[model samples]
Target: MAGTGKAHLRSSDNAVLRVEDLVIEYPGRDGSAVQAVSGISIDIVEGETLAVVGESGCGKSTLAKGIMRLINTSSGSVNLLGTNIAALKGEALRTVRPKMQMIFQDSISSLDPHLKVNALVEQPLKVWNRGNEEERKAKVRDLLTSVGLDPEVVGDRKPTEFSGGQCQRISIARALTLEPKLLICDEPVSSLDVSIQAQILNILQDMKERYGLSLMFISHDLSVVRAISNRVVVMYLGKICEVSPANELSERPLHHYTHALVSAVPIPDPTKVSGRAVLEGEPPSPTNPPSGCRFRTRCPAATDKCAAEEPQLTYAGNGHYVACHHPRA
Candidate 1:
């Protein structure tokens, strides 16, 4: 069985993952393409949770899938654990894939309702040939117990028998079965109830520390990201708008689009805060994204400069980064 409780696997001495100018596009009808992620770059230092936050259709999921090689990159490089994922192919890709895993948004759809929990958790072990049948069964029980589920009771049951939160825990257990070094969580808690979301978050935090995991968490919930992520990356129309330490990004956002998103987060004290900013409009279509900055249409600080030249991510303060010509400072 894999070691539990802070195994200390992170290489703090170097960045475990690096993405440079990553781009993904899907061919469409009439010889056109829809750019899903456009020239995005990010670095994930070992053992850190980097949260990617954005509105719907902002390409957060696409970026995560791109990093996992679920979707082909049109251009750019994704280097994880010192391997260029874009260039990996066939057996090489399959060999490298075991180190990275993903947990999707809807646990309901992700799980196989037809399969029992024992089979579900043991699937990875079977595929990897980690152990004999008896050993695989033992590992499955251990995985269930680690996730705080009753191994005896849940192991024989099907996914359809569990609650939404329970189903998510099962999904997490399945993701961990591979003993992945990097886990990409795409809106893991978005589909749960408000109260259940907290429970799921606590479980995820526990798992992160226990497994010495590096995470790329994608979500639209800023509050949840603030609570769980060590660092933050904000995306707009398939491009990164800002990147910063979680607390710093929440308190001192730089990009106008990021600022608007920060302002929209509900303050604990109703009497102390007001003026929730409603951005001017929806995100532009990826197929026909605007020139220069994609956020110019909705950003209050947008100017002629923003509409003329695209901005590269640059340091703002205390490791914070922004990709806007007119950052809020």
Candidate 2:
């Protein structure tokens, strides 16, 4: 039930990353073009973290990839720092590469095992010729230390030798080497232990404050998102179902799909039981998604109108927006 609308987004002047009507499609099963992301418009203000959460096949990762231009998009504009990077190409695109960086879900796999940790962190600066040899090394040490890694101890080691948490720390240091304005993290702490997850998250928050970074964080961990993000964007089958402030979403979700996701997040206390919104069956195919409301296949409040016409994202008051035929109010 997602349609084109910009009501959910803030002023472009206040946003560091603004995506308008973004679409990303590619070949799927039987050669059908799978619309991975369909007409998504979202923005992240400077020094804010916008978290995108949904079920596995909801295209959360694809949306991040599309904005980063790690994969080519079919059509749309990705405006970063007042410039539409989606339309830029060749030398121009390469020139702006340092302004943005992405951290993958797999920490170890994302880093280079062949290179030492110090070299790994310094690589980005070297590529862009940001500083002289000594200056780069000094900057790398400062960043590694900022991430809670001792440069003296772990600097000469490769990524494989370190634990999952340490590898993620090294990745973060590398990402910050160029002082990127925007960082896209694809479940950066999902693979680590719970304690490790907290450590990494703290590191991220510290880095964000230190560098004035705007973040687009994609994760299935709603708890983490609510704790760290300024705002949350609930996605469903390549479309955004809701956009609300993080605490506001946790307390009062509107969209049926968003409600389901919020309900599924386990409550911290065991003495009190929370109501569950159990979704039946699996998600429909994205190659040929259900007409009208894509979440209708699994939504309980779906009706003939939901099947006939798509819902546009409309303001639901108090800085909340939802796209649904029957919002939870």
Evaluated with TM-score, which candidate comes out highest?
2
Q: After superposition, how far is residue 48 of candidate 1 from its true place, in Å?
A: 0.7
On residues 1-329, what C-alpha lDDT tens digit does candidate 2 reach at each position? Answer: 66557898887888899999999998887877889899999999999999999888889999998888889988989999999999989899988889999998899998978999988999888788888898988998899999999999999999989999999999999998889999999999888998999999999999999999989999887888987899999888999889999999989989888788878888879986888887778788788888888889888899999898899999998899989989996
Candidate 1 Cα misplacement greater than 4 A, ranges:
1-13
Model 1 gets an lDDT of: 0.84
List, residue by residue over 127-176, the lDDT tens digit for candidate 1: 88898999888888888888889999998999999988999999999999
**Candidate 2 at residue 136, lDDT?**
86
For residue 34, model 2's alpha carbon misses the true position, in angstroms, by: 1.1
Error of 2 at 129 (Å): 1.6
TM-score per candidate, in order?
0.94, 0.97
Clashing residue pairs for model 1: none
